[model samples]
Target: MATSKDGVKLDKSTPESVWKQILSAEEYHILRQKGTERAGTGIYNKFYEDGVYKCAGCGTPLYKSETKFNSGCGWPAFYDEIPGAVERHVDNTYGMRRVEITCANCGGHLGHVFEGEGFPTPTNQRHCVNSVSVKFEPKQ
Candidate 1:
């Protein structure tokens, strides 16, 4: 299992400060407090170049450019994530049961994952990621 920059284990359990230092106020609210950004209001929503998307909080590789698809969910959508790079938990915070996706390394929330997308992918999973949770590294 890959560890974070500060050596935090890439699992669901991690220290709070590890998350705090790596993320900003808005990032913390969305990733840790389960706050949602308004749809179609993220910078990455307009990104259309080729690149890999990584966790902004910990620099962990999350999604590849190839796996990205136009889901029209008003956020960056991907069909898959890097192997063993994320962890999911059942979130019941907002009076609904949803799988909350987080960075495996630092426990920073990326977004949610859902099934039955009917996309042309093996998993048929749609990872609705927050643009604030990720940064794109454009391919040269």
Candidate 2:
């Protein structure tokens, strides 16, 4: 494992080797290829426990339990992210305007962030993340 600048542990190996060692074909397809999983099928969809959500590829703390909210979007949604923990890029794929979110330390695709969610929170942001991109560590 390689620790990135933000202390996220990313697989330092080549993409092929990392693909072979760290992920299955399906996982690779969804995470590496930027494919979307069927909504409501992800393990994190209903996770309401208090915990820190880390990047699956690189164990960087991304979201805190306090920031999580039910966006009813079938994905694990968060109103905010750990400061400086993620990076956003403009995505022009599929002919849709989207903001691509990635682990700031490792450049791994986590998901996308959207605005105008109309949540009561001041940020009014929704970070719709893929379950496979995150691992939860329950708070004690």
TM-score winner: 2
In candidate 2, clashing pairs total 0
Whole-model lDDT, candidate 1? 0.82
TM-scores for every predicted model:
0.82, 0.86
lDDT of 1 by residue, 1-140 (tens): 54667676644465667677766899879877777789999888657789889887767888988888778889888888999888889988769898999888767778899899698877899999999989899997
Clashing pairs for predicted structure model 1, backbone only? none
Q: How do the residues 1-102 of candidate 2 rate in per-residue lDDT, one tens digit apiece? A: 455455534653435455546666666666577777789999998899998998876678999999988889999999889999988999999899999998
How many Å off is the CA of 131 in candidate 2?
0.7
Candidate 1, 124: how far from true, in Å? 1.2
